[model samples]
Target: MDEALELGEYLPQSFANLNEQTYLDFLWSALRTNYEAERYEFASLAFHLLYMSFVSFSIWQIRLARPGQFAMAMVGFRSEEEGSLLDCESPFKFYDRLKESQIFRFLKLIGCNNEQVGEFAKFVRRRNKIAHPTGTVFFNDQAAIDEEIASMMKEVRNIEAHMQPVIRELYHRFLRDSADPEEREYTVLGDEITANFVHKNYMSAADIAFCQGFDIDALSGEPLHDAMKDLHDALVALYPAEGDVEEAA
Candidate 1:
C-alpha cells in the first residue's frame, strides 16, 4: 500500500470514536438561547443557524487549505504543463487538480479522500445559497437545508479527527527531509511561530505579517487583520494544546 494510504487509514476509526452528541448539544443550546432572546423565534433560529453555517464553512476552508498545501508540496513542481497532468493547469480549475493529485491518492490511504472533498464543496455551496440575497423566501421548515448543514458538519468533524495524526507526521517528515537544515529549520520555526501567534492571540493578518517581520502597510493596501481574524481563531481552535491553555491563563 502507498504510504499516504497507510498513514490515513486510522482517520475513520478516530472519527468513529468522536462523541458528536457534544457538538449537537452545543448547537442546540446556541439555537435555543437565541430563540429565547427575541420573540422572532424563527429569525433567531435562522441567525444562529447562519452562524453555525459560516463556522462550518470556515472549518472546511482551513481543513482544505492545509491539506492542499501539503498536497502541492508532494507534487514537487509547479509548471503549467505539469499542473495540467493533474487537471489543474488553468487558474480557473479548482476541483480538477485536487481530484487528480498524488496527494489525494495518498490521503485516500487514511480515508481523507475525494469523497470528503465533494461533501465540503457542497457545504460551501449551500452556505452561499442561504447567505446570498437571491430573492427566494426562506421558511422555518427548511428541513432539507438543515439536514444538509448537519451532514456537512458531521463530515467536517470526521475529517478533522482523522487528519490530525497524519498532519503531525507530515510536519515531522518535512522538517527531517529538507536538504538544507538551516532553511528548513527557519521555515518550520516560522510556521510554528505564526501558528502560535494566530492561535494564542487571534492576531490579524497585519499582526501576523508584523510578527513575521514584514512591512506593515505595503502588501495588500488594506488592514488585513480584521479580515484574517476569523481564520486565525478557527485555526487556533482546531489545534489547541497544553501550551495554548498555559498561554490563555
Candidate 2:
C-alpha cells in the first residue's frame, strides 16, 4: 500500500485527483479485536488451534509443491505396479491422521534427517491431548502453558529447517530444467509457487503465525545466486518493492 501511494504520486494524471493522503490508512480497518484467556483450558485450546493451523498450512503447501516422484509416492503406491483402481485416494485422508501417516518416512525421502523428523513429532502427542476430550481437569497452570508454547515453536523450527530446503531445490530445478529453448519458465514456476501462497485478507496480527507451513523462503537465497536474481525479477513484478516508497512533496 505504501508502495502504491508513492508510485501513485508519479501517476497522478493516471487516476484523476488521486493523492497520497486519499487512501492513506486503507491497509486495514478500524475495528480492533483482543482475546484474553482467564482459564487454562481455554488458553490450551486457543494455542492448539493457532499451532495446528500453522503446521497444517505448511503441509498443504508441501503437498501442492511436491515433485512427481514424491507427490504420488505419499499414496503408498510408489513401489508397486499399476493394479488397484483405488490408487487415486488422497494420501492424507484427513489432517487428524497426519501423525499416523508415513510423514516421517516422507520427510526422510525429501532429505530431512531423523532428528528433524523426530523433533516435529515431539508435539503431536501433546497437541492430541488438548484436541480431544479427556477426563483431565483444568486449572490455570502457567508453567504447563509455557511448556506447550515452547514445544510448538520447537516443532515450527523443525519444519522450517527440514522442509524449506526441499522446496528450494525443486524450485531451482524448475527454473533451470525447463529453459533449454528460451529465457526459462521461472515466471511460470514462480506463479505456481506464489499462487499457492496468495492471500487476499487485509488484516494483521496473528496471521504471521499461519506462515509456518508453506513455500515461503524456499525459493529464496543469498543475492549471490543467479537463480535468486531470476526469482526476484519474477516476484518484484507482482509485489512492488518498499524501496520505492517515498512521499511526494
Candidate 3:
C-alpha cells in the first residue's frame, strides 16, 4: 500500500479513452488492471528478457526512413562517403547483426554527443549480456529499470530532435505536390492531414518521381525548433487538433 501510494505521488495516474490510448497507455493497462503507470517496467523487461524493444525499434527505424521519400534512414541521414560504406537501400537487410552493422554510427550521424553515444553503446551491451543467459544473475531494481527506459528514450529523442526539419519538409511537400480532389478518388489532403499522418494512400504510393520532385535539402538552414513549430502551425491551419493532444507526452 505504501509503495502504491508513493508511485501515485509521482505518477498522478493518467487515463485515456478507448480510441485515444498511446503505446505506453496500452502497455500499462495490460500490465496492471488498475492502469496505474508503472513506467520503466517494460523497458527493464525489454532489455533484460523480452524482444519487444527490437519491435519498437523497427517502428522507429521505419519512421526515420521517411515512408514518402526515396531516402532510407541508414543512407539518407549520412554524408555521401559515410553512406557509401554500405551500399544498401533499407535498414531491414542489416537488422540481424545490428551490433556489427554500425548501428552506433546512426547516433553519430544524427549528431548525438560523444557522451550520449557512449551511454547508448553501454545499454546495448547490457541488453546483450542479459540476452545471452550466461548463468549470471541480472538485477533489475526500480532505479535500474528507470535508467534503462530513460536511456532508450533519450537516444530516440536525440534523433527525433535532429529530424524535425527534414520531416516537416516531407510533410509540406506531401501536401503541396499531391494531386487535387478532381484527379484523386479519396479525401482531400487538408482534411486527410487530420488523420494519423496525411493520407494512407499517399503513404503507399511513394514513387521515385514523386520523391525526386521535392528537394529535402531546402530545409537545411531551418532550425530544429523552428521546423517543429512550423509543422505544428501548418497542421493546425490545415486541420486543427484537439486541446487534449497538447497535454500528451
Per-candidate TM vs. native? 0.33, 0.49, 0.48
By TM-score: ranked, best first:
2, 3, 1
lDDT of 3 at 29: 45
Q: Can you write out model 1's per-residue Cα lDDT over 1-249, one digit (the tens) per residue?
A: 122122122111111113433443455566545444533334334433433333332222233335565344445546653455344322123333433223233334345658765554554455456567777644344454354435645654565455544444432233233324344333444454344333222232322222233222232344344323333343345445445669988
What tens-digit string does per-residue lDDT give for candidate 3 at 98-198?
44325554544445677765765566567666657588645435555555555555554454455444444455554443333343343544454434243
List the RMSD of every prediction in angstroms.
Answer: 16.0, 12.2, 10.8
lDDT of 1 at 31: 50
Best by lDDT: 2
Model 3 stretches with alpha carbons more than 4 Å out? 1-43, 47-101, 107-109, 113-116, 183-185, 194-249
Worst 10 residues of 1 by lDDT: 7-16
Model 2, residue 218: distance off in Å is 16
Model 3 RMSD vs true structure: 10.8
Clashes of each: 5, 1, 0
The global Cα lDDT (0 to 1) of model 2 is 0.42
lDDT of 2 by residue, 68-146 (tens): 5445545654343222212323222324344433444455655667777676665556656766788774434766556
